[model samples]
Target: LRINDPGIDLGVAAALYSSRLEQPLDSDAVYIGEVGLGGEVRPVSFVESRLKEAEKMGFKQAYLPSPNLPDSAQKKKIALLLSPV
Candidate 1:
């Protein structure tokens, strides 16, 4: 399979890697974003849709790029974890 998107899973991969493989990320959380080589997370496309899909799939939380965070946060049932710009 081919992953045309630069590296959308890098954020979560970095977190898992940084933990020295001793700890794991929250299984109930959804992480969305592209991580740069410098460990900074860049915004990805279709963030709102992604969050909505995740919420529908039983994910209660999401970590995404700050710029991609939706303004309707107060109305969403899931928790959106906005990254700092």
Candidate 2:
């Protein structure tokens, strides 16, 4: 099976967001990564810019691939879950 590289992240986010309506997802959290058809989370490029934008938007948490993570203090607040988010 093939995954639509560009749309995977948005598709995953939409699914996650819809599922969280009843449980309530963390409003300050952001998710940035590609969800493969095998359910694996893959890293994307331009991570710095993405994280910078998220931070600017007041997001206190982020779920991203390990390889895309930064060691900055701002990134310390991130939450990475390899499994379904």
Candidate 3:
């Protein structure tokens, strides 16, 4: 749980971690989003690039904000979990 990147957004990651403490997250899934104080997940910038990188790195899924989803994501073959902030 030690984060190395200060610039990395962790709102959604924190929520996921807290919610899934009893169960581990999927190893092949990448999570990306900002969390609001009210626990809503918000979109981040460069979502397409991030998803592409995750796909290239062999990730099978992603959890991101709905607003961050790219139109071309359907072609990437990665499962997406979208939430609203």
Candidate 4:
């Protein structure tokens, strides 16, 4: 899971570590957000596109910022974990 983009994905990294230490994370879940230095999850741009792409690839859940949620995404089957930083 190498990300070539310049944007940071701290939330995903933390989730991966958690998965490694505890029970494995849901295979159907996709985590998308940035974790700040103070350990806060932050919103990113183009959230709708990201979730749509994840759904297209068969992901059943997405962890993202609450403020970034799109109305269109609610119509999809993907469940959202809206975090507030």
Candidate 5:
């Protein structure tokens, strides 16, 4: 499920991981942090848009880093995973 492409972005990686996780990313939610060398989840750009897209797609949850989360989104119907970087 590796998105190893020249135009690879966090969204691509997240989509791949979500598909592997069997979450049906078309209407599911997922996020990729910085992606450390050790495979740790780090903070990524545009947290708000990611969450918003998930919600718009009818996804009831999300996986994201705690550091990059928005205060307003913390209380949404979505689930947030405070992953370690």
Candidate 6:
């Protein structure tokens, strides 16, 4: 779960929380944008390479917004889970 704390950057928060909560963040690095009031995790640009990097680093899954899924990578060999805000 994401908490919207203006003082904390979502990227750092997610990473730290993932570590603290022992979540499956794995080697998947995040490129989180600004956090929203409703605890929404805003999206950045093309995250395909990010996903690929995560997969390359032994991470098999990615969690991001549905619209962020690259069109060309829609059928690629990777695990991308969509979480609605």
lDDT of each: 0.69, 0.64, 0.64, 0.67, 0.57, 0.56
**What TM-score, computed on C-alpha atoms, does each candidate reach?**
0.72, 0.65, 0.64, 0.69, 0.52, 0.50
Give per-residue CA lDDT, model 6, range 1-85, as digits (tens).
Answer: 7764432355566777778988856453444344667867666554666666656666544556555656654545666443332
lDDT of 5 at 77: 43
lDDT (Cα, tens digit) per residue for candidate 5, span 1-85: 7654322244567777778998866444454456666666567676666666667767655656668766654556445433322
Which is the better candidate, 4 or 5, if ranked by lDDT?
A: 4
Best-fitting candidate, scored by TM-score = 1
Task: For candidate 1, report its TM-score.
Answer: 0.72
Q: Count the clashes in each prediction.
A: 0, 0, 1, 0, 1, 0
TM-score winner, 1 or 2? 1
Which order, best to worst by lDDT?
Answer: 1, 4, 2, 3, 5, 6
Which regions of candidate 5 are displaced past 4 Å? 1-28, 72-85
Candidate 2 weakest lDDT stretch, 10 residues: 76-85
Off by over 4 Å in 3: 1-20, 72-85
Reference-based TM-score, model 2: 0.65
lDDT of 3 by residue, 25-84 (tens): 667767787666776666777777777787788887777777766666464554544443
Q: How far is candidate 5 from the true structure (C-alpha RMSD, Å)?
A: 5.7
- Which ten-residue region of model 5 has the weakest summed lDDT? 76-85
lDDT of 1: 0.69
Sum up the clashes in candidate 6. 0
The list of candidate 1 runs beyond 4 A from truth reads: 11-15, 73-85
Tell me the tens digit of each residue's lDDT in model 1 across 51-76: 77887888766777787767764436
Q: Which segments of model 6 are wrong by more than 4 Å?
A: 1-11, 15-34, 77-85
Please give the lDDT score for candidate 2.
Answer: 0.64
lDDT of 4 by residue, 1-85 (tens): 7876422475467567888899777788777777768766777887777877877888776767667676654645445444433
Cα lDDT tens digits, model 2, 1-85, are 7765542484466557679885666777677787677877777888767767777888776677777667666455543322224
